[model samples]
Target chain A: MSRLSGTGLTLAYDKRVIAEQLSVEIPDGSFTVIIGPNACGKSTLLRALSRLLKPAAGTVLLDGGDVHSLPTRTVARTLGLLPQSSTAPDGITVAELVARGRYPHQGLLRRWSERDEQVVTESMAATGVGDLADRNVDELSGGQRQRVWIAMALAQQTPLLLLDEPTTYLDIAHQIEVLDLCAELHERQGRTLVAVLHDLNHAARYATHLIAMRDGKVARSGPPGEVLTAALVEEVFGLPCRVIDDPETGTPLVVPAARRKTSVQAEV
Target chain B: MSKVMVIRPRAVVIGAGALLAMTAVAVLTLGTGDFPIAPADVVKTLAGQGNAAQTFIINELRLPRVVTAILVGMALAAGGAVFQSITRNPLGSPDILGITSGAGAAALAVVILGGSSTALSLAAITGGIGTALLIQLIGGRRGLQGYRFILIGVGMTAILNGIMGWLLTKGVQMENARALLWLAGSFDGRGWEEALPLLGVLIVTIPILAVVCGPGLRMLEMGDDVAAGLGVPVKRLRNGALLVASLVVACAAAAAGPVNFVALIAPNIARRVTRAPGPNLLPSMAIGALLTVAADWLAMHSGYPLPVGVVTGGLGGAYLVWLLISERKAGRI
Candidate 1:
């Protein structure tokens, strides 16, 4: 069963249509990863689902109601999104930045409360940024900064979280660290996690549900073991590859075909 | 790590200090002049204990000008804080962004065309709102963000300044002299007529800014996507803030003839003093009142009297140059 789903969503910016008649569903309590080639409308779909981009046609339903029709704050209390890039206000501390996530729950009369303070503390600790609370966000490393941003989303305390290319700018180790944190949130906290990722192997290894896209359409989606076959990868990503089981996790992994040795050589 | 407190004690202390300083300047300003009432006498007169002559001087002659200065300063600073926060740029105050220039040009037009003071005020407000809408239209539908909006505003300011200079040239000798004095931004001959209107604007706008828009604007500094993801109505909030800020800048311009840099410098100074990020609206308003009152006092006491605008213009110009140099050194520009 799924609590968040889209039906016939047509997403566009200005006059340029990125996708038409697209539909998707995020399973309840699953770590879902979406992977596709560049400009395949993966991020557009995520934006539509998160209600950042209003769909030109059709609807995104959250809990059997149109998400766009609901009050924004009400939707925010149930769902959170970490955008691809967000600027930290200059001279902001890690704790202050995380505490801003409690905005939806706060109001003019209802200022910051003890619950807000406790939530901010726990969010920072969950993302291993408790010690960096007093440090400036500008002074943190890329990996630590990413963790702080995730901690902010965690502070929102939404049951459903969507991240658009959360690991895009990080080193490989940081990418894996972030993915591990997402996986932990899904497994231990039973939060529904949907993320767009570039690394196919990581997506396959970590995602309980995998979605592959091509030309603004979902080419295949299911359990990673069922959806991440060599044929679907070749069709979706246009890469000639062989699929093999990962030794440690027993999940399907792709190995690109080796290029033939060139016979023509330039004279030195 | 130590617990991070939501409220900063330093900001509260600085706010209190600024309020006290403003009160001191107000009292001192009321006491100085050719009549030269003592500060103690000024306080007593304010409390209804003064002699008839002292009461007439304090109540009738000088008090209105001081009130106008305070209200104009608060309006300008509040407007500046809103614009800077919205654009996320320190250089995005009303004066730099052409908002005051728009009001100045309209007020100049009314003066040159022999309009009443009431017409002048209304015209200034219309001009300010029109300029904001023009900038918004040209800035495109992407909403107010980044350096693009600031650059467009800078361009608009240049155009409006040229218009103002041309308008000044068209007036007759007597009208030209009057327009020039107004352009220099003086408190001479100002009375309850000017102060009351500004007070009305403040009463209407300040509460809305504090209670409705403050928290959402703070969220907007993180970027639009993050703000929207947190459920802030981004477009509506930006437009509403721009409208309120334009009204403020226009009203202050009508009262004080575009008093140079209180709007540009007050919020920046408040942010530095408080050592807090975001708009710093209340502190900025307090510091603004202090700066204007202090500048007016200096203008009155200087061996050669000058318009209050000249004092602020010289100081603000220097501050601008220093800010540019420091921002360049910091690699922010």
Candidate 2:
């Protein structure tokens, strides 16, 4: 089993520090979701773990080896990342965009191979973008575009995958659709998955391992049923809310407290 | 055997056709200059069998000019394609990024300071790299994102153009005429001395671009974070690509004095015509060669006898206006 861990990380962008001495361990073959409010450093942690943003101190370890010290292509072969925002080049076909994921496996003289084509096709098929292979990526809908981007990441064929806010900019149905795809990829493909999601309910429902963060620190890290509580919700989000079992999956569902009637009457 | 080649049939066909057109233009350019040698004589002279007059005309007088035009066009177009790919915008050519103007400014300084042509060429290269570094610094760590890079480049170009104008105003008649002709990017009186520097740069840089950097540009088109995630050394690759692009543009500027609009328009034309998903480096170079050769031919034979840069500049300016309106409509501006 491959291990992905970030230990004693001190993260900063320029002089502004975001996290100090932060450590995280992703459970193998589990779908881990990090949930936090905006500016809480959830995405920043993901970036560090995926080697997008180097930690100021400490290291991200993959299989007990420092990710930064290893050859980038080797690390990339073991891990894949789908960032929060990916802009599709103008007039690029869906197939072409997905094929770019094979960069790590290619070289100046080694070039594209049959294995690359096969993997790209399978990835597109898995993400349900096979039908749109010839269509321009810029012409796709938001949901379709997101799926294509995921397809590109999947084409890397890494054992571990990290996604940042993968469900953002999607409506309720599309959000569920993408989350469902991620769940399927985790459960069926048996790959380790880590994602930073904004919605607590979606994270609770889809995440096998959930990590709730507040102010760049982990508030709780455990199974959703064990970690998600009304008290913790109030503590992290500063919202008075009830945590209950979801009807469909029995995961935690949050319902915020209603406004006081006295305050409304006073307004009147 | 492992599969090592990815072929684009459309680009190949388009490139071949462009090459054929360029060859025809080259023959016409050689045969019609000054004394009017026949096309057969030009071909025979190229094959080392023409009479002294035909040989001298084709080999000495006309061949160098045609070669300079083709090489400069190819270099500019290739550089433009690389810049546009790195920036992920069709408008981000070397001309727009202030590279050509930087080279022109340095070349003008050389001329005004009474330096030799060798000094001018070397200074032009140095100027391009320096200006590109300045733009990169001003654009900050975001590299060429949004309109920031273009805006910074425009500011740099304005400053360089001011210096060039001042230099022109300060020079005497003979020197001013020479400087003015160079600024207008004429192919007249250009010989092997000018062609050699550009040829050497192209020989070294073009292979690096086409074989190694070109493929990585596809990943770059997906944004920096994603490109980094895909195992591309984004900063290193971006910097290297920028350096190569700057050098190529500088060499072209040194050879042909800031030939306007070839770098700006060639890549876009190649992209539209070939419709390739990745960077159209080769096709763009071919298109650039054709456009420059055709423009030079028109410049020589158009009765009014304008500089080659005038035609490209006028046409490119019109295209720029159309592009701005279209981009505005598309909400990209």
Candidate 3:
């Protein structure tokens, strides 16, 4: 059974509606990736599920309780989110930045316990940022900085974690590095992970369950083997593509169809 | 159980040092005026061991001005740190948020109307708070997000400055001089009447801000989405901090008539001294008290007895120019 789910959600910014009555479920202990073309509302759906954006209509359920109805700190203890863009304060060290994730577990009188210190250390180690704890976050490479951010989310120690395009703006190798870390957290730590990704192949490779969106609605959602196909990719992304198994992992790989060479040859 | 609170040694050292320096300056100021009490005698007077005449001079004549200067400095500095953190810009002090301009305009109006000092103080506070509410209503639709709030505040400051100029023109010569003296910001002749109210507000608000809100506000420096994701009620915290900070600024204005640059420069100086990230609220307060007390001492000792505001304004203008150049060199402007 799913622990986090949304029903009949109508998302919008101001007067402009982005989705209407959209429903989704994130399977417990599964690596679920939501993929869609630009402006397809995947990130908005993630925001609503994380309770960063309140839905105009309907409810987001966490463990059968309405998420919006719960105390924000209570919800935060159970769920952590890594937003698409967040700036580290000027001159903040990696450890200091990661320690901020303890906010939900902290209070006015009960700040920075032994457990908090242990968790921050473990989170940094788990993300391979332990050695860089003293380094200024502003001076880190993009890949290292992304790892530090993930460490911060890990420090929250929540069972469920949401990432909004966590791989954007990174190079291909860094993207793979970040995805591998997410996969490791899902596999080794048993975190129920939800990520909105732009790369179809990466989603297919890393995601145990996939949700493909078109316009403002879910086009298909299932295991990648069943949901990712040439026709589905064409329909959802409006791209003519061929789907083949990834040689390394046997997951679906989308290769866009090459354009005809007649017009190019004539121009040349 | 051993509570493992994060503590920076450097900040602690800086805070302690600033407190010591501030006390030294305050004591020296108390001893240096026309009566010329020695520092030892000033300490004795503070300890209630001085003769009646010295006691009267210290308690009745000089102590109130020093206390008011310290309180106003602490208030403005704390307010400045809050604004800078919220806006994530060094220039985002209470002055930039139009608090000083609003208070100045209202006080000018009172001076022109030949109001009593008590009425003038009340008017200044009311005007500052009213401007804050208006700015929040207009620019806070999307929460107190960064550049938009600063831009709106700049616009409000411009409008209020125009009003202040027109009011000055409408006043007679004597009234204009009175208004200008108040505008220049001073602690001359101020007594417990001003210091007590400011102290009361600071006593209630500063602890709450430092203990309850400081960590949450630090989280906000990461951005709204991140802070919210971390379970901070971002809008509520921002609004609450803004209101509390505005009230502090208004009260300081009432006490000292819109002292310039203490709010603008204190937080930055505190940050540099401690070399710590986040708002550095406590350090800012200490540094602010030191800066004001020191400046007031210099003004009192400068032979001609210039207003404290003139000294700060002149020094702050130079500091601002240096700040712009340094920020530009760092490519942060």
Q: TM-score of chain B, per candidate?
A: 0.97, 0.96, 0.95
Better-scoring candidate (lDDT), 1 or 2:
1
Q: Rank by DockQ, descending? A: 1, 3, 2
* Per-residue lDDT over B140-241 for candidate 2, one digit per residue giving the tens place of the 0 to 100 score: 476687788888888889999999989888888788788888989989989998888789889999999988888788788888988888899888889999
Error of model 3, residue B271, in angstroms: 1.1
Which digits, one per residue and each the tens of the lDDT, describe model 2 over residues A74-174? 88889999998788877778888888889888887787778898898889989999999888888999999999999989999898999999998999999
Assess each model's interface with DockQ, reporting 2 decimals per model.
0.69, 0.55, 0.61
Q: Which stretches of candidate 1 lie over 4 Å from their true place?
A: A263-268, B1-4
Candidate 1 lDDT over residue span B1-333, tens digit each: 335556677778887899899989999999998899899999999999999999999999999999999998999999999989998888989888899888888888999998998988898898888888888889837878768888899999999999999998898878878888888888878899999989999999998886799989989999898998898988989999989998998899898888999999999998888877778889999989888898899899887879999998998999999999998999989
TM-score of chain A of each: 0.97, 0.97, 0.97
Segments in model 3 whose C-alpha atoms lie over 4 Å from true places: A262-268, B1-5
TM-score to true structure, per model = 0.96, 0.96, 0.96
